[model samples]
Target: MERQMEPWWKKSVVYQIYPRSFMDSNGDGIGDIQGIISKLDYLEKLGIDVIWLSPVYDSPNDDNGYDIRNYRTIMDEFGTMEDMEQLIEEAKNRGIRIVMDLVVNHSSDEHEWFVESRSSKNSKYRDYYIWRDGKDGQPPNNWGSVFSGSAWEKDELTNSYYLHLFSKKQPDLNWEHEPLRGDVYQLMTYWLEKGIGGFRMDVINFISKALDLPDGTIHPNNLYGDGSPYFINGPKIHQYLREMNEKVLSKYDVVTVGEMPGATTDDAQIYTNPYNKEVNMVFTFEHMDLDSGPGGKWNVQPLKLVDLKRNFEKWQLALHKVGWNSLYWNNHDQPRVVSRFGNDGEYRELSAKMLAICLHMLQGTPYIYQGEELGMTNVVFPLLEDYRDIETLNMYKEKMEQGISHEDIMSGIYAKGRDNARTPMQWTSEGGFTTGTPWIRMNPNTDEINVEQSINDSTSIFYTYQKLIQLRKQHDIITHGSFQLLFADHPSLFVYKRQSADEEWLVVTNFSDQREQLEWKDCDVTSKSREIIISNYDTLNTNENTVEIRPYEAFVVAFKKGIEN
Candidate 1:
């Protein structure tokens, strides 16, 4: 594919906000658009160029608004369309772009279209969703929902099973239907016309289901079957995306990003290839799964440094010449990076800064999930009752029936639970959020690790992030440089170089607690009179031909051609 002119998004840093956890305006306890609008200046101070908010679309609160019931309306809890419009305009005044979450993979079962479809078998909206007959007394196939149980939910009224890859409240739409596709395109146009910046497509890869609707490989000792191969990255996905670009997205100068759960490097290249006109970039789960065990996310394991280096090397190299990558460590669906990959105890601040340096130094657009800058940690809810995510609740029930002990499940919840990231934004201990109760409790360590404290301490993780973002803006090499791994086999050190025509930058990171050597002799690039540009540590340790990296130390240096000390 031919390259096109680089867009503003490629050079912009994105901040993701889980609206419900950000802040609350009214005493009702849920976060609203007015809350987000009030925090616009705070986000601007953090130096974010784009803000991507998770869906606030009309919904029944199942799956946290992923089950959108109305494309044009805002959820009642979030406020009205007027509030959203005000948010867009206010954000623009601060030079910040607002990217809305587009969750068309499914619609809430309570949606008007779904209600009409379920009314009768011959309804005009009947074909808007995927419907099939049950076999004998079971669902259409052994496909299981991501939450739990069968992906096919029986419609008691229509006597047919409607497909729901997630919670039963979310029914998947059939992309094969011509009129449905037209409707989606028109909906996108409506948003662009309203002056919204762009869209962050939710579960976009699952839109085109394998038309055959066949049985899947069943998992022993598990309720759901592995039916992902049939629907994920389906055959006509590219066709559908290209059609989307042609019909709606390309008309606006805004950026588009798709959340692809199982997309590969090749798929990402095609999707973001400007010539292909699919998207500007994509969020892939390849790097995030490095610590996953045999049972997947819940069954967690220690992050292997080799596996991590390999994952980054592969994606960086594969996309360096073709597509672009989106760098991130935490999101609404995942736990905090410091707690998951770094030391959350004695070395929390050091490790958080190191992780930030390592990811931002790469050749890609970097995203900062809310609270990540404050070095926030995962919340370990004591009992299952405290959890709010649907997936977390279902996993507890399914594992309990299978005889897994509560202690074992809670251990996994501590490591991989979605609630870990859903904790209320720790602005302050008291009225920073609301006088009312938070939808979910704030992280108990708020007094020590909140925005109020971070903003005051110059050495805090928040400032470190600010410096990294500023570096991206100041250096062209950061946006368009080629990435090369220096120590691919090193277990503790993650070292790489980004180079353009005349500039060279070396990024060295110690991802562990042990102090390590720079080992310049073993690396690919030659040593120069390098000036240390950024580092987590306040002091530098240098020797004859190498530098000593303290525990969890991260530093970036600019290399000059031939200067001798």
Candidate 2:
């Protein structure tokens, strides 16, 4: 029998680059395609197989690149179309593939299609977007925008309101229309034909909405209502995605990951099941939202290690053979992982490595966001004007209007604002990103934490990430082994085991700042010969039953299944 081959993406590691903050080669203060092309060597050195580039499409900068104006053209600030093509070619030259951001749920109101659709009620493109008549001098529904306020925007020319789940400038597309879906398919085909690797879809689950556009339940403390129930993973989401796969995705040999905000484990199984052919995997927000209070993302709260372990165990076992999972710690819209989940002040390097080992050792593909390998921390801008994220600014303004104190609002922003991940990449101490002033302020601690410094130090977080990536490629157990969570209820320790037919790997991580002990009776290794694969600490000691774990320390021990002591 012929040997079977698995998908290349299953064994690959991805690195996400927020183009606007990655690098700037033209001294224009904004990262561009040419800038990314210049750093191909750096990414190659990191051993990442795919570069998940955030949106670089034409936009008005209202919500950064997320609100795209043109799907085919590159943003002027990020360079021309030629530069983008060069980036694709250059990245490929270094054995790296580029994954573009697919933002089909909505487009900039300034887009030609939206402009034409809103030009007149009788226009041919009017059905390209979601529009409905107002109700009693108000919006069509009491839906709230993800960026706050109402989700409806009135248009005087058509005498109607258009739905925008995010920014008013981003009018949601009418996926119910056949022609609109065809157009999106064609655009996707264009990129895939251009030698791009895959796509990281933006809010893909929100593309389908309830046809009635019903009003959501109103929260007592809020102005508008929660509209996610009507839009997220709607009635026809599967039909639309299956159609999309058949029309565009199935023909290509590329990977696809959808960013689903409200997706549950069951929903994810349906979306990512190989037989369904919807997507290769989905980015679930369950783990990310664990640190939030009932008030939502801005309501900052401490993360419980037990809660995190249980959540991971549930997903790992639920999707083991049924589907796949996409693991990540930080992204463009999230706060820095080190500052949020690890100790960024005293044991930043050790904590960062621990977090990496905990996630990478799981049974899924891992993503490393820009500057995450350097152990970047959250930036606490002193003033509201210093913050640039629309969500942050809107929350501050709305809270102040409700008689909230400046100190309280600022504290939340410092702890959970999206701008925490938008700081420029720290390549060096002296304005490494650009010659001109950065669009957003650089983190003040960039002097001590940067790629240059990290790469030189053997004990830096960058090397730890590099070693983890290398391990995934070298060991089949890391990719195909079954996962089992040990010490599930431990308050400060995360312990897991991955076992294959003839190999077993033990991954232990200390989530707290204090030393802990791992004494799992079921995970005894007295007779098996053990090898320390990778560790954050310089020295380690382990006995047959229990191991003494230092503060924020992590290590992986490998054993040959049939070998004796």
Candidate 3:
């Protein structure tokens, strides 16, 4: 299990910033580039090496900047290109690298390329986006958009249908076209020239489309049927990616992490091979989308400890020796990890620390979402109108049109809505994310569990994360170490060990609300080599033979070649 340490990314901690709510600098009630500039010191103090900023490109805000109107221009709401340049310089000065979001799979309808494409069928730029004649005056096939229904939207002026996997305003680009591919490559090169560290590619795998464009099976709830399987990770995806890699990314020292929605480990290995030169890493949704059904429906399933462990183990084992995994629970798209994965009811502090223990111990780069360390919980929306996420709002409207009861829809929203995660970041006791009211309502619980409170509490989840990150950096074993899951079959316990030539560590976490125990018979430690390094329950007496883990308790035990186990 011993190994030699390597790259800093293998040990670095990445912090995700949803600029719209991370902070407000100009009192515009919205977070911006200057706002992010003000927070560099905070992130540097938190030991963040990478700051992953979500889309700040000019957009219509139809999908909150995902619909990019201009790849080169910064959104006016966020800041100007000059402001971004200053922010980047400032972050670099503070030793924090900036990773910008790359949303190239689609572009806004207003984008110059899309505008020209939709202008006329004979337009030279028409090939940039996917467009086809309607079948019998209906959408081209039954393909559906991720937002609600019909991924294919009709362009009345052109008498054609354009593909939009997400929202109608965000039309899918045609990667099959060489010119389009060249343009994207140039965009990457432009940013690299500007000194950006890397890219968090948005829906990167969706760039490929089904060669045959065959109709997939239909679900009762899927208005346009389940066609994502056919459209995602299409035939020539890797080919296009390799071309991009050669043209742009391979020329730089950038670390590219792609957002692959339905990518498997096999697919991951091909794209992220160190020698392959396609991508540096990828973010898989296998664990994040566990609560959703095959057709992207929220099924309201309580996360079982066994299921959670299984998902974690799958990725850990699959990518252990192949490509790297991006270990995280919260992002701009997902709810807070403390609330989603941990028990946030009464023991939120313990649960928050426990979640961090579970994730960071895995062999990968760890991403900390803004406000996540504060143990942020989901928003409590009294009405559907309270939500601001475009996806949530669209789904609500679509479901209502389908005759779904408002009460039932509200219940579904409570269980799984993107808005729950998009609420304003709680920075003060009064939840003053802005001088005026925030763009969206702050979670009511923010009044008590804000940044102001956690920054002052040594035992707060925020500080726990700070310590965890510091440990990852300080100890080579915690980073670039060989990972082996211990007690892998344990019902309620997730136990793993990280080992390097110089050190070894055992990480054990109880995912349930009840006390759990690990029998030495099922553990991987030897009689002469283990010592308790950290324990959440504070009952880590090295004299004990069997370890007792309280509800949501976690312990990290360090081991040397010779020590009493």
Q: 1 or 2: which has the higher TM-score?
A: 2
Q: lDDT of each prediction vs. the true structure?
A: 0.88, 0.91, 0.82
* Best model number under lDDT: 2
lDDT of 1: 0.88
Which candidate has the highest TM-score of all? 2
Candidate 1 vs candidate 3: the TM-score winner is 1
Please give the range of 10 consecutive residues that has the lowest summed lDDT in model 3.
Answer: 1-10
Per-residue lDDT for 1-565 in model 1, tens only?
Answer: 2224657787789999998988889967888899999999888888999999999989899899898889889999999999999999999999999889988889999999899999999999999999999999899888989898889888899899999999999999989999999999999899889888899999899999988888888766776679999999999999999999999998899988899999999889899877899988899998889888888888898889989998898888888868788999999999999998899999999999999999998888899999999889998876688899999999989999999999999999989999999998889745377678888877788878888888888999999999999999888888888888887888999988888887678899998989888756565434555678899998778755778889999999887644443
Candidate 3 residue-wise lDDT, 513-558, digit = tens: 8876666545656635667666676565333356667888988877
Task: Candidate 1: give the clashing pairs.
Answer: none
TM-score of each: 0.97, 0.98, 0.96
* Model 2 poorest 10 in a row by lDDT: 519-528
Candidate 2 vs candidate 3, lDDT winner: 2
Error of model 1, residue 528, in angstroms:
4.9
> Cα deviation of 558 in candidate 3 (Å)?
1.2
Q: On a 0 to 100 scale, what is the lDDT of residue 81 in model 1?
A: 97
Give lDDT tens digits, candidate 2, residues 1-565: 1213777888899999999999999998999888888888988988999999999999998999888899999999999988888888888889899999999999999999999999999988999999999989999999999888999999998789999999999999999999999999999999999999999999999999999989999887789989899999999999999999999999988999999999999999999999998999999999999999988787888999999999999999889878998999999999999999999999998999999999999988999999999999999887788889998898888989999899988999998999999999999976499999999999999899998998898888998899989989988888788999888888998989999999888888998988777653456553247788999998775566767899999988887777654
